[model samples]
Target: MKIAIIGTRGIPNYYGGFEQFAEFFSVYLVEKGHEVYVYNSHNHAYQEKTFHGVRIIHQNDPEHKLGTFGQFIYDFNCIRDSRKRNFDIILQLGYTSNSIWFFLLPKKPISITNMDGLEWKRSKYSAPVRQFLKFAERLAAISSDYLVADSLGIQKSLKKRYGKDSTYIAYGAHPFDNPDISVLDKYELQPENYNMIMARFEPENNLDMVLEGVVKSGDETPILVIGKHETKYGAYLKGKFGQYKHIRFTGGIYNLAELDSLRYYSTLYFHGHSVGGTNPSLLEAMSSQALICAHNNDFNRGILGDNAYYFSNPAEVATLLLTTKKSDNLQLVKNNFEAIKRDFNWEKINGEYLQLFEDCMARHQSGK
Candidate 1:
């Protein structure tokens, strides 16, 4: 089957969840003997060439760095090009406001979109932008042939907000094999000495709350926060927390080996995201067999089940940090690892995606 993935910043995934999803799915589909193409942004510095046997279509746009406007332009150009490609299916990872272009495509490809976390509820967006996002999400749901939600919580949100029934297909995490031991020396963190938090330094991620909680708790365990230090929030976090001897802010380690090493060695994983549906980082940390103490939310609970710890207020988190025993948490961590292996592995997820694609194509052909 010929497939095209759209609505992301492009490959090599230097950014967030959807980009990484696209990268892994594209490569996996290619490996499975399917022809796959991805839309790459001109600003990404990616060559117009095949990567891992998957074709990359470079959409050149100079204004592609201008936030929402750039995304609009990129999506419009990608849709224009997609019409000419005659793809069997087009998978959009997010709701692009310019998605009206999909309606103009010649093939009228079976469109499948992953309705990522509730963008409208994010604290960073202005009132107008949030209102616009709500409308765009409705349009995408009504227009697309299939809508996918990464978690049941997101599916519920879609139904409540837009009156749309979405398919629940969660994101997958790749398993890490042997990690390099030398990378541990960089953080001066032994295998189980420090608590780790890996996520974007955004307002929704609640990094400040976590930091303040740690400071208030005064748990002797050191904390290491890893993420891209590009945003204003990230900069502020560095400015405020940089001097602390117990807290180490390692700005964005991109190498997979280094990331995996951190994940595998960390004693505990701190997840403070109050929004979003089944965060990729949380799932990955669980897969790595780290004891996960996630934000108290239905999404996190659904994924971790009863095998993980949850905390709402800083006091609860602080209490957990001080009271939980490594020996007692070991079984829960092992259970989470077992669950991930059984349910969230990339191989299983890729097969599920292919089946969904085929079903969408069949339904489209049958005039359903």
Candidate 2:
């Protein structure tokens, strides 16, 4: 089947979870005898070129710096070009609020969108933007032939908000083989020496809570926070905690191997995201076999099952840090790994998407 992926900052996954999801699924779909094309941001120099048997179509506003506006331009250009292509299905990863072009597309081409997380609930957005996002989400839910929810929590949200039935396909994680010990020494990290938190410095991620909790805990163990220092919140975090000897802020380690090594050897993985559904970092941590401690939420519980430790208050987090034994959590990590392999492996998850696309196409053909 010929398939096209729209509404993501094109692949190889340098950015967010959607990009990574597109990257993994595109490659898998191509290998499975499906022709795939990704909409590349025009700002990227390589946007005009094809990579790994997938065609790359460039969007007018490629910088992706324009936030929601950029995605609008991307979807417009994609829809315009899509009219000329003989694609069986068009998969959109996010809500396209600015582009009315999607509504113009030929209804015969099956439209499947993964609604990602609840973007409107994010604390970083302004009141107006949040309201706009809520409206956009409703439109996207109603317009699409098929909708995908990344977690059960998100599926529930969709049902409650729009009364739309959504397919629940969890995000998949790639397991890291035995990481190189030399890589650990390079970061001055001995196994179990530090707690690790890898996420964007956004308000919804609850980074401040993690930092304050760690400081209050007074545990001698260092906390290594790794993510991009590009945002205003990121700069604020660095300024606030850079002076502390126990808090090591490595701003965005781009090297995949190095990041995997850090995750594999970490004593405990800290996930404080209070919003969003099935965060990719948390899944990656579980895949790395790190003993997980996450912000207590239905979303995290749904993903981690009984294999994770959760905390609601900063005081509770501090208590866990001081009390939980590193060695005792090995079984928990092992159990998480087992569950991830069984349920969240890309090989299995991607096939579900492929089947959904096929079903959507079949339904369209049958005039259903």
Candidate 3:
């Protein structure tokens, strides 16, 4: 089977979740005797023509200069190039920008879209932008040949809103076994002596709420704010929290090993994402044996169950940071790690995607 994955900045996961999925799954497909192609931005760091036996297609990406509008152009270029490739499956990772160009997608390939989170619900976007996102969601749901929801919450919402049937496929993570305490040397950190949250500096992620909790707690224990802090929101957060010596804003660290090690060693990992399906970072935290304190919502609750503490606001976060004991939550950490191994391992996730592609191909051949 010849498959092409679109809708991410590029592979090797320089960005985030969907790119990570593309990096792992595309390589797996190649290893399994299938030809896989991943579309990368023309400016992506890794400018190679191939990666780990998978073909790499570099498309013109003007996002650096045009901002958000450049993403639309990049997706358009990818789809236009894909038209001539005759791929058996074109797996789109997200639809915020690509859905508008669905008409240009080749008719021969089966179009399968992974409906990500409800982007329209994010507080970061303006009202008009949110409305546009909602329209994009609807377009992607109806335009694609098949839809995939990364979480049951997303799947249910899709059914209720669009009356669309979608496959419920969650993300995956590898259990972190190599815990090098030495990785903390550069950050001047010790094991179990700090707390952290790794997420984009967006309003919906509740970063400000969680940081406020850190301040209110007044524990003075170091709390690392992972993610790029160069955006306007990032600058605002830095200005707001810069006085606190413990609130360290470490810019984006792409090394998975370092990130997993940080998660493994942190006393309490805060997950404040209020929108999104099974978040890849959250799963990585779970797999890395981090004792989590998540934002109380259906999405987080559905995944963590009773395994971690839940906080709805700054007050709850403060209370948890002040009172929660790492020793008592050992079992919860164990449970989350076990969950990753059992259900969210990369091998299992890769196989499921392959099966889905094969099934879609068979149905297409039979005119179903």
Candidate 4:
């Protein structure tokens, strides 16, 4: 099958989850004898025409000059060019930027979209923007031939709100049992010596709440907050939390190996994401065998099952930090890694996507 993947910054993934998925899934699809093409941002560093047997097409992205609006232009150009490619399927990773142009999309290829998270509910966006995101979600749901929800929580919401039936598929991770502990030398950290948090500095992600909770705990255990700190909110957090001597902030590190190793060696991993279905970083943390401390929500509970400790606010977070120690999470860590291997493995996830694509294509042709 000839497949064109859209709606991400593209592969080699210096960005977030969608790009990471594109990187892994596109390569795997090519290896399985499918012709896969990934649309990359024109400014992305990897300029080659092909990467790992998968075709790469650079689409213009003026995000630097135009900000969020540039993403719309990039998607427009990508869809326009893709219409002429004669691809069997169009797999769109997200719809926030492109759903408005759904009418302009080609009618020939089967369109399957991955409906990611509740964008409208995120606190980062203003009220009007949130309404626009809600509309976009509806447009994408109506426009696409099929919907892929990354978590059962998302799947259920799609059914209740949009009255759309979606296939429940999850993001996957590969575990590294024994990564090099020497990677911690540069950060002045040691294996199982620190607790950590990995996430973007967004309001909805609840970084402030977690950090405050940690400070209140009064446990002098080293807490490493790993993520980019350039945003306004990020600066606020650094200013707010920097007074605590044991709280260290490392601006985002994109190297998965390094990040995963950090998580693996952490005394505890805190996941504060309040929105989204099946977060990539959370799974990576689980895969790395970190004893999980997660926000109490359907999405996190769905992923961690019964193996994680949940927190809703700073108070809960502080209570957990003061009460629980690394030794208490040994069994929980083992259970989480097992969950990743058994259910969220990339082999199973990619296979499920392949079958779903084939089914969508068949149904599109048959008018089912």
The top-ranked prediction according to TM-score is: 4
The TM-scores of all predictions, comma-separated, are 0.93, 0.95, 0.97, 0.97
Best by lDDT: 3
Q: RMSD, each candidate, Å?
A: 2.0, 1.7, 1.3, 1.2
Candidates arranged by TM-score, highest first:
4, 3, 2, 1
CA lDDT, every model vs. true structure: 0.81, 0.83, 0.94, 0.90
Q: Model 1, residue 97: what's the lDDT?
A: 52
Displacement of residue 280 (Cα, Å) in model 1 is 1.4
lDDT of 1 by residue, 193-217 (tens): 7888888888888787777777778
Per-residue C-alpha lDDT of model 2 across residues 1-368, encoded as one tens digit per residue = 88989887787776778888888889888888988999877775465467788778877873347775766766778788888888889888888443356577766578888988898999899999888888888888888878999999999999998899999999988776678779877778787778898888898888888888888898869888888877899989888877788898887887777877787888878899888888888888888888888999998999987898888877878988888866888899888888778999989899999888878777787889
User: Which pairs clash inside model 3?
Assistant: none
Model 3 TM-score is 0.97
User: Where does model 2 exceed 4 Å of error?
Assistant: 45-48, 62-68, 96-100
Please report how far candidate 4 places residue 31 from its true position, in Å: 1.3
lDDT value, residue 157 of candidate 1? 86
RMSD of 1: 2.0
Better of 3 and 4 by TM-score: 4
Clash count list over all predictions? 0, 2, 0, 1
